[model samples]
Target: MPTYRTTAVDAVHNDEELRLNLDLLEGRRERAAIREAKAKLQMTKYYNARVRGVTFSPGDFVYRSNDASHDVAGGKLGPKWEGPYEVTEALGDGAYRLRSMDGTILPRT
Candidate 1:
C-alpha cells in the first residue's frame, strides 16, 4: 500500500534548500526593483516629452485662473480666467510674483 504524505512532511527540511529558496526570493526582489525603476524612468521620459515648459519672466502679462479667486461668480458661466496680471518677479520653477493691473501685489504665489 502507498502512504500519503502532507506537504509539511514531504518538503525538504535541509539548510541547502532553505538557502536556495532565500536566494531565489532575493533575486526576485532585486528584479522587481529594477523593473519598477525602469517603469518610472519610462514614465518620466514620456511625461517630459509631452510636457510644454512654460516660464514667465518679470514684467510679462499672464492671465490667472478664476477658480480660486474671491470675485468669481455666475457659476459655470463665469469667465475661466482673470488677470492680465503683471509678473513682478520670477520665483523660478514656474512660480511668479504677480501684481494686478491696479498695482496691488498678490499676497500668494
Candidate 2:
C-alpha cells in the first residue's frame, strides 16, 4: 500500500478502491522514473557524440590555437596555430597541461 493518497475520496473508499488507487499511483511513479531515465540516457548519448575522440598523453607535441587579437600582427596571413608545445600533463577528457619546447609551463587560458 502507498503511504500517500491521491484523492480525499480514497480515504472513505472501501479497501479494494483504496488498493486500486494506490496501484495506479505506483504505476504512475514507475512510469515517470522510466521516462526520466530514458531522457538522461539520450542526453548522455548526445554529449558523448559531441565530445572529441582525441586524447593527449604526457610528452606529446601539440599546437596551441592562435588568439584572435594577436592575429592582427600577421593579419589574415598569420599562422592559425602556435607552437609545437609539449604536453606536460594529460588533464583528462581532451584537456592538457602544456609547456613550451623550452620547458616553460604555459599559463592556463
Number of the top candidate by lDDT? 1
C-alpha lDDT of all candidate models, in order? 0.85, 0.81
Name model 2 segments beyond 4 Å from true: 1-52, 68-72
TM-score of each: 0.75, 0.48
Candidate 1: regions farther than 4 A off:
1-19, 73-77
Clashing pairs in 2: none
Q: Residue-wise lDDT of candidate 2 within 15-43, one digit each (tens)? A: 88878988899889999999999999999
RMSD of each: 3.4, 8.9
Best by TM-score: 1
Mind giving the per-residue lDDT tens digits that candidate 1 earns over 1-109?
5545543453556667888899899889999999999999999999999999889888899999877675678687888989899999998877789999999998873
